[model samples]
Target: MGPPILSAVDLDKSYHSGSAELVVLRECSFALANNERVAIVGQSGVGKSTLLHLLAGLDRADSGEIRFGDRDVHAMGEIDLARFRNRHIGMVFQFYHLLPEFSARENVMMPLLIAGEATGAPARADELLAEVGLEERGHHFPSELSGGERQRVAIARALARGPEVVLADEPTGNLDHENGLRVMEVFERVHARHQTAMVLVTHNQELVSGFDRVLRMGPGGQLEQTDQEAPR
Candidate 1:
């Protein structure tokens, strides 16, 4: 395998609860290979979401090094980081954060518009919606779509910029079993189609089955590969 597309080294983060320091991450390190799918599973409050946020540059580590290829993520200034994230990193949250007034295609076209690539934004959004099996729903608003369909739209929006890596925090956590399964199928198809590397943080062990690597985050912010079997 070649060098990782994204990586973190000796990461540390802490929050102050009154006078007490809540250490969320300590010496945490990770790496994501090109086009690889990695699942991070752990008990609640184990910093899984924290790690994802740090990787996506949504949050800062008290001290650490985050790298996307040769570029240091944390080292970038605000404007540069924002631009980098807009063009290179895609983020998906458990709750679909679609704009209430925008249609599905409009939501998918958001990143493209923000990046000043609006020349063909509509066509690109349509293509992505089609990829996620939502071609016919492009005219609908978030309120009109079901939970699963909303999530699929979020997924389509995430892939809008053709990002090198997607950091997803519990992408399937908000859905029922059937909808969750549908979302997972969409992920499988999207990964296969775009070859986008993904770091998925999920509490559901069953969701990790198709990933290339499964990592368990300990309460101390340590990450280790797990040999635990996923239910068939």
Candidate 2:
């Protein structure tokens, strides 16, 4: 009924490699609605992460449009784009991009700090760390934590901003099966508490059972639902 939380139309992106233009996304188009959970499954190099970047306004598409509600994401200037991203978008990458110098709590507090809330950030950060099951590890730096712990910290950092839609690029990629399930549980907790929409790019079909939809990226850089499996 309402406008989708995010959408892309006739999107295209490519990489230039010294006289060779490698096309990655070809007329890619899709949307994720409010409180919806979507899983993207495909083999390596299907431009899944690329599409996520485009959707997040981290990178611009070569042509076509990406919209966040009524805002044209592809048309915003740098400062406006940065503000918009900080206010409304959260991203978790396969490699946890936690700052090495900061503790887990500090890393999770950065977004709030940037938004100019100095007083209560630590408490908010505590809430996020606890939600992700990392409350005990908040004092540890990224190098001091395990791979799974680092990823959980990253997830906490992503949720710190209370973004409307979270874009996760292989959020569980490097974890063991048990760790992967644990990370997924943190996602579930986030959804239950915040009702954030999520677009997750993952290879684990087993994880798809927890999402509202599963769409696979084809060789042509187009997206298609694998089957009409009922939503979870």
Candidate 3:
């Protein structure tokens, strides 16, 4: 095994509700290995999404440190952090946050465009769309696509930058059984092919099968390792 690609230590976070302080994570910490698929599963309000957000640098922690390789994520300045996040960490949310104005191909091209590449984005976008099984839907806008198709577009967009870590929170929560299965198949296929470290947290227990590891988060943000079998 190699050194962790992403790691958090003594992660602490909380929110204030009037006079009460709701502690979400109490010094939770973990290290994700290279190309590892980790599922953090728990019911709602148990800090699953909070953990993912912290991992992605979308939210700051109350206390602790996060390391993406040797870079200090928590301590970096906003501009540098934003660049690092854009280049290294890919995030997928429950609601496919596709730009309604942009077509599936354009949406997938976003990361490359943001990096100041005016040319070659479209071709890369098309390749990603096809990889996610969205080649036929590439010209469609988010509003014109099915829920699963939208999610596939989102997945394709996330992979556009070839991120080292892909953090997905409730990625399949909005899909039906069939659509959810489709999304997972595409996600697994892409993950296996790219060797990207994927951390997906979901409340749905049925989707836990193909992950390399399952981490069950309790009601209080406690974590325990459960299984490590992954399909080949």
Candidate 4:
């Protein structure tokens, strides 16, 4: 309806291996409306993760413009970019990156602490942990949690700063079918509760049931809308 909450235009990215150049994205473009849920599906090496990284401002595009609402992400200085990312964007990787020594609640409180908002971080972290069905496990360390539980903790941490958008890369890649389903259920509950916009890069199509749209990334780094029942 209105301008997209997040958008990129004419993006291009490449890497150099030895004397050769490997192009990952070529003139790729994308958009996400406020509170929209989008799933990106593709074969491995199609630059799905690259696109996600670009969208999250984790990496800069060689040539492109990334805008989160009215802010130009790529144009910001390092300090401003880091602060912007900490406050506005959340990220979840395939591997749960929780600090080993910290309890689940402490891990979730990380973003708040980094942003200098530790005054009520503990209470906020507990609320997020509870939202993800880990209320009782707040005191447990990452090593003490199951694979599914760790991923849920990561999700809780991502939501700690009340980010407007969450960019997730293979959030359930390490889980079994049952665990994956549980994680998806948690995502659904979190979405309903917080209305956070999500852009998920996943190979598992079955986990994309309730997403607002499904995008298939081609080998050339172009994204095309795909049918819900599209062939795998």
Query: Compared with the true structure, what per-residue lDDT tens digits does model 3 show for residues 2-121?
Result: 899999898999999899999999989988998988899877899999999898998899999899988889898888888888899999999999999999999999988998875989
For model 1, how does the per-residue alpha-carbon lDDT over 41-65 read when each residue is reduced to its tens digit? 8889989988998898888999999
- Positional deviation of 76 in candidate 1, in angstroms? 0.7
Tell me how far the alpha carbon of residue 69 in candidate 2 is from the true structure, in angstroms, after superposition.
Answer: 0.6
**For model 3, what is the C-alpha lDDT against the true structure?**
0.88
Instruction: Assess each prediction's global lDDT (C-alpha) against the native.
Output: 0.92, 0.90, 0.88, 0.91
Candidate 4: misplaced stretches above 4 Å? 229-232
Clashes in candidate 3: how many? 0
Off by over 4 Å in 2: none
lDDT of 4 by residue, 1-232 (tens): 4578999898999989999999999999999999889999999998999999988888999999999998889999889999999999999888889999999999999999999999999999999999999999999999999999999999999999999899999999998999999998998888888888999988898899789889999976899999884322
Candidate 1, lDDT over the whole model: 0.92
In candidate 4, residue 25 scores what lDDT? 94
Q: Candidate 3, which segments miss by more than 4 Å at Cα?
A: 227-232
Clashing pairs for model 3 are: none
Better of 1 and 3 by TM-score: 1
* lDDT of model 1 at position 134: 94
Candidate 4 Cα RMSD after full superposition onto the native fold (Å): 2.1
